[model samples]
Target: MGASCLTDTGHEMGSISLTDTAHEMGASSLTDTGHEMGTSTLTDTGHEMGSSSLTDTGHEMGSFSLTDTGHEMGSSSLTDTGHEVGSISLTDPGHEMGSISLTDTGHEMGSISLTDTGHEMGSITLTDTGHEMGSISLTDTGQEMGSISLTDTGHTMGASSLTDTGHEMGSISLTDTGQEMGSISLTDTGHTMGASSLTDTGHEMGSISLTDTGHEMGSISLTDTGHEMGSSSLTDTGHEMASGSLTDTGHEMGSSSLTDTGHEMSSISLTNTGH
Candidate 1:
């Protein structure tokens, strides 16, 4: 008399039911009462203790946030204790599209004063602020294209990827995890300026310098080019340089020297073939 339930070949038939029935069907350790769970299906595939229901009825398809509301799936608190209510929520965080918050329980995800925090692509960070694509934590710092607290798992598509230009790839914040104070600087091949030839004829910023030309070509750098930049060499934290036949030079690198005697100066266009 502990608990009872009758099954018709894995199918509930008659008025037979129990407190909690443990039946192994379709590789699912199922527990059925008014709620059928433990199948690792329809979401609730984790350690859950909800008296409602779970609706994990999907498999390796795409990004999903299964919440078990009156029957939230993943790790959701339905709040309302209405019985026999089958309104299940989906919150699957283990998903690799770098799920993050998909399954949010209002307060836990944020607070009751706030709605479900994470779920849709536009719902991750407070959408009222902006259309955030990266992780929610990044929202705390702020972003334009990339996220705040995201990894390759989330930003493997280049949208949130940093421009490996040795500089801090992301915004400085109280919660920026993957931050580098300029290490692997990006190197972009400069556009062929003269003769439409990939080779530099030592005419302008020749690929081959005069042994003291720093041998650096097309690389970005920050050198006081005698131009006397305003207030600061560079107002921003990002790197800059004189893109004269070159794009990137290196750390604070500048033109070697100028032949003051009737020297023929060629024109090199300024360009950024971003990485």
Candidate 2:
């Protein structure tokens, strides 16, 4: 449809229906406004509808799925029932879901994942499939998840940190690797966990760790090893230290400060030494 207009023969087509009817390239350049619909207007940049890479990547509204390379699926969205291009898509190999991830080349994957309205992708991921490689990688270069948010009802609302870590919940991991001021690099639940099944750093159960700054938001463990509290670990300007709190081991690229809110340190260890 090369920019459809009042043809030589003025024929009125109120509903320009193209059901399963395929059209070749050279389709109209579509009015910059995708919603110009009184005349059922359509803008198709029909440049080789397959892998060859179509120059017209902007197929404005209704629904769109890539049929070629140079695809910018992220900028557009699909609403037709099962409108997902790839269950897991990325320039890298490893797939990610629920969790966000990145490659050694610094290619940020699954940058963000969340169940949209319908609660589809509950645990968003930066990577596909949601699981960081089980390798001892970079502080920031290594695979990581940011948060596992939950909607009030508590049915696993949303968690960026929980996606691929395999943990039920996660906070933030401001990394010390990139030049972007600060990034998070702290927790890993790894691929088979529940909300309460994760602990922070050495706890093995997310007993308690730092949430960006070092503040104890929950009850500290009366038993556990290597638990040392820092001077500003529990009390910050925006946050206050409750009674029972735990400090994260400052070893192996861990948090220098942490805290929990209403969380109880059920089974953890705390030594007088600072990791």
Candidate 3:
């Protein structure tokens, strides 16, 4: 099944099964099934599929299937289970994916999941996640992220997690974590962080954790932690650490911890046997 140069109208191609299928130029509503090879290209729009087992290629205003092999460029909302072999890009203005439950096992390079101008992303829930060699950036002004949970995940080789430039973060929880040569930075100006908790963590090889630059912080707790050849800093100007409890235990080696840059700390507690 191959279609091309279909211009200036809405076309619906449904229930197709073929090898080397292509839909290009102003075709809409593509529903296909049992395709060994398929490609939809160049200014095609709006795909709605049910059980379309395809090695699919979609670009520019296209929707995808339940078992689609590859999807790229444009906005799509998929429910049920699917495996994507390539990548998915949601890089148009006013594009959003809401209430998605699926698993993606592939390498996404330079993938912009959500970076829209003058728009806010809705709540997201992800389970059983892992990534290698890419940076996940959620940096937008005046945006808020609801509760995020990561379980049994690992990162390597200088991956960074940044949420900066006046954005607010809700509750974040990490459990049984390990990082190598990675950094977590949250440097937002004039904002606040809700309660954060971390447990059973290990960091090696000069990893740094910083939360700085003029903001307020709520309750933070770290338990059973180890940092070797690393630095932790929390320095800000004209901010306050609200009525919360900060505790550190069982730390070794020549470590440096500082929380001083003309800010008011309500209550602080440091209890350990060694430095």
lDDT ranking, best first: 3, 2, 1
- Score candidate 3 by TM-score against the native: 0.31
For candidate 1, the TM-score is 0.17
Clashing pairs in 3: none
Off by over 4 Å in 2: 1-163, 167-180, 190-275
Q: Tally clashing residue pairs in candidate 3.
A: 0
Candidate that scores best on TM-score: 3
Question: What do the candidate models score in CA lDDT, each in turn?
Answer: 0.20, 0.23, 0.35
TM-scores across all candidates? 0.17, 0.22, 0.31
- Model 3, 1-275: lDDT tens per residue? 12422122223423332222323312223332312222322222323211112123322222333222222212223221122223322221221322222222323222213232212333332222334424333333334534333232434424334334444655444343545535443344445666444443555524434344545665444443565535443444435665332233345444435453556676443433355
lDDT per residue (tens digit) for residues 1-275 in model 1: 12222222222212222122212211112222322222222323322222222222221211112332111212222221112222222232221111222221111111111122222111122111111112222222111111112121111111121111111122111111121111111122212111110111111121111111211122222221112111111111111222233333222223332221111222233322221
Candidate 3 — what's its lDDT?
A: 0.35
Which scores better on lDDT, 2 or 3?
A: 3
